[model samples]
Target: MGVEERRQQLIGVALELFSARSPDEVSIDEIAAAAGISRPLVYHYFPGKQSLYEAALRRAAEELATRFVEPREGPLGARLLRVMKRFFDFVDEHGPGFSALMRGGPAVGSTTTNAMIDDVRQAAYEQIMSHLDIAEPPVRLTLVVRSWVSLAEATALLWLDGREIPRAELELQLVHDFAALCAVSAAYDDGMAAVVVRILEQEPLEGPFGELVGRLMAIAPTVMEQVVADDRTA
Candidate 1:
């Protein structure tokens, strides 16, 4: 392999090792053996184990960050669903590596690693905010957005940990939960309420939001009667 190709090959090997285990658990000698090269050759590309670990993480982080980006066009719910699918796909492909990166297991946790993780979190948050085209949002409005972002991260981790739930169902449920949160947040904040109203107005009836609103509208009367009857029973 060419020099650059060899470097990437080494990184690929390192990433596989990292995914299977942890940073500290994988040694320089093991990496060299895995790559079928001498220890000195591995050192030529990466100074040591830490550099190799960080390089592997940086690659993963870049790929993970890219998955969060989706076209800003179309309904907010549609856009979010697309983004959520990309996010989950990454989790499915790199569940162990992702878990280590996000949760900072003992072997990989450190100041530098945590800082890198924070950068990925901020990038995902900014991607959502940028697409929303929000400016000077009220405190509660911003809080709601941030909360959803955090929830998405936590939910992905949990979803990976327990495979009992199908990914498609999780994605749809998350989208619905976000819509529900918006409705709840809007009830407390007129600013958010107005924003949501504008979004609903602009949303095409064939999109995710449209489907959600139509379904909820259809079920509202029955749901409301059930709630009232339950209250009476209590």
Candidate 2:
């Protein structure tokens, strides 16, 4: 293969290995063997395993960042659900590599790796904000968006371990979680309330946010009954 072709081949091989296990567990010899080349030839293309890992990480990070992008033609809740599905698709495919990138072990702990992770977070944040279509978002609105982004990252990292929760359920729950966050903030801030109102205006009863409303409403009578009983006792 040519020099560029050889480098791309090595990166592809390394990414596959990294996806199966943490980057630290994979060695130069293994990468070279996987690429069907000598260990020294791997060095000729890249200086060491660290460089190779970073290259693979860059590719993964770029893909992960793009997962949050969706066309702004649907209800916000639906848009978010589609984005979540794509995000989980990446996590499901690159479990070990995603974990290493987010959790940070000795092998993957470097300035470059951390920056890539941050870039993914920022990209996700910007995408959500654009979906909101707010010109000047309030401080609380900013907090809600950024916090949801972090929550999504943490949720994916925890889900990678054993994956106890059904993936589809988690995806829908995350959409609900975003709405809940905005709703709670909206209660206190007029700006946030306007944002929630605008989002709900575009939502449908069958959508995730509307489903959350239905679920909450279903238990409202029981909750209110308990509250009335406690008030009478008091």
Candidate 3:
């Protein structure tokens, strides 16, 4: 293979190894052996194990960021649900690697590694903002989107530990969580309210957001009755 091709092949090999186990556990010798090359040849392509690990991480980060890209032709809730599905798909496939990267296992505190993770988050933020189609989003709106992104990351990390909750259910709940965040924000901010209005205008009753509304509506009377009873007791 040519230089670039060899580098890419090594990266691919490293990523596969990294995905299966922590980068810290995988050594240069293993990478070289996996690539069917000598350790010196591996060094010729990269400076050290750290550089190779970063290259593999960069590749992983790029792929993770792309998972958030969805075509803008569906209801906002559906689009987000699809995005969540893809995000979890990556997590499912790269369980150990995702855990290590997010939890700061290998190359922890490394500026480049942190920046690549931030780049992925920023990419997700931009994708969400584009989906929201907000030219100048209010602070609350931006907060909601960024917080949801973080929440998704945290959720994935927790889910990886035991995976007790069903992945499909978690994916759906994340979509509902986004809607809930927006609704709560809308209650306090007029700008968010308007955004929510615009979003609901495009959502169908069968969509995720609408289903959330329906579920809340279904229990509203009971909740109100309990409130009334508590008020009377008071």
Q: TM-score per candidate, in order?
A: 0.87, 0.96, 0.96
Cα lDDT, model 3, residue 17: 82
Candidate 3, position 221, lDDT = 99
lDDT of 2 by residue, 146-213 (tens): 99988998998899999999989899989999999999999888989999999999999998999999
lDDT of each: 0.82, 0.91, 0.91
Candidate 2: stretches off by over 4 Å: 231-234
- Candidate ordering by TM-score (highest first): 2, 3, 1
Considering only N, C-alpha and C atoms within 3 Å, which residue pairs clash in candidate 1? none
Model 3, span 1-234: residue lDDT tens: 999999999999988887778787888999999999999999999998778888888999999998999999979999999999999999988888888888896454488899998999999999999988988899999899999999999999999999999999999999999989999999988999999999999999999999999999999999999999999999
- Model 2: how large is the Cα RMSD against the reference? 1.3
Runs of candidate 1 exceeding 4 Å displacement: 1-5, 19-25
TM-score for candidate 2:
0.96
* RMSD in Å for all candidates: 2.3, 1.3, 1.3
Clashes of 2: 0
Model 2, residue 159: what's the lDDT?
Answer: 95
